[model samples]
Target: MPTDIAFYTNPMSRGQIARWMLEEVGQPYDMTILDYDGTMKAADYLAINPMGKVPAIVHKGKVVTEAAAICAYLADAFPDAGLAPPVDQRADYYRWLFFAAGPVEAAVSNKSLGLTVPEGRERSMGYGSYDQTVTTLEKAVSGGQWICGDQFTAADVYVGSQVDWGLTFGTIDSRPAFEAYAARLRERPAYKRQKELDGALIAQMQKSS
Candidate 1:
């Protein structure tokens, strides 16, 4: 029997990354849409994630929070999707995947909040500076057709989503390399399908509200 997967997320958050990864995994998952100020903070949801985050998942009775973690988990859980490299060949995968979640997330969020680390405090911050983080990501994704070089693994799903959303929201600079890489990821069928589904869900929610 297929493992039971329950995806708890909102349509407007980083949950889209997990949804796209789920599509790539080719697994049937039941989605429970949670509101930002409503069900997301309820006791039942808080049990899965104390932080009351929007993108969390329950798979086979195990809960996974954070968008990158959910994507990584789905890739490993459905190895048939080929969304992951073998354990011994996961150096690039782990590096960029976690880098996107850490530095990329920090840089974008901090910049959007009009917060910047002073030059003297660059060493204290994990992302150094937004420019440094963006340039490094540009080089990383520009290395080849994909983040892992020649494979469209879960790394692309996580990292590419960050780049794409950053560019859209003016959080990250629109570097040529980032634009190109994001383009490649957007052309995937799974990404397109995930966008369509989430777009519809958002429209429905808007209409009801």
Candidate 2:
């Protein structure tokens, strides 16, 4: 039987984020592993995502791309998963989710590539300064529960991934708040399962190459 969801990804990419969300949703899905220099950029895939990126999904014929968007979409699509805050209670959910997608992602990528914002030109960048972005992120997750209080919404899946990856790669500061938040996220069964699935795929790809 085919699932309504068709996930296209590479285990080594941001696809891991979507995979975690899928695991949390507990839905059956079919996965297609695309190679970076091959089918990922092929015409069929480019038709699905012109950006030629991994981490794209087709749910009931509708295509969704970008890791953050995928998490949010899955949460909404699978309401039974309880991965999204109620409409009236989504202020923090939307805020922090997009915060990680926008400011945190931009800050980390720019810093990794050694692209510093010129002094006083921080206003031009969406994230302002990298230090400011990191500080703001620290405050958001320091609350000790989830991104949206007691509920473990999709916002955590997206925002937490940024913190988790940042901590592992040293792209973000290793503050107690960030560390604590990631520790809690690690405790999720879905998170652990996502890692195991992707880790095995990565190992296989490496062995074959």
How accurate locally, in lDDT, is each candidate? Answer: 0.90, 0.95
Write one digit per residue (lDDT tens) for candidate 1, span 1-209: 45499998899998899899999998889899999888999999999999998798899899999999998998888898999988999998999999999998999899999998987999999999998998888877988898777888999999999999988888889888888888888899999999999999999989999
- Model 2 C-alpha lDDT per residue in residues 88-119, reported as the tens digit of each score: 99999999999999999999999999999999
Instruction: Give the winner by TM-score.
Output: 2
* Model 2: lDDT to the true structure: 0.95
The residue pairs in collision within model 2 are none
Residue ranges of candidate 2 with Cα displaced over 4 Å: none
TM-score of 1: 0.97
Per-model TM against the reference: 0.97, 0.99
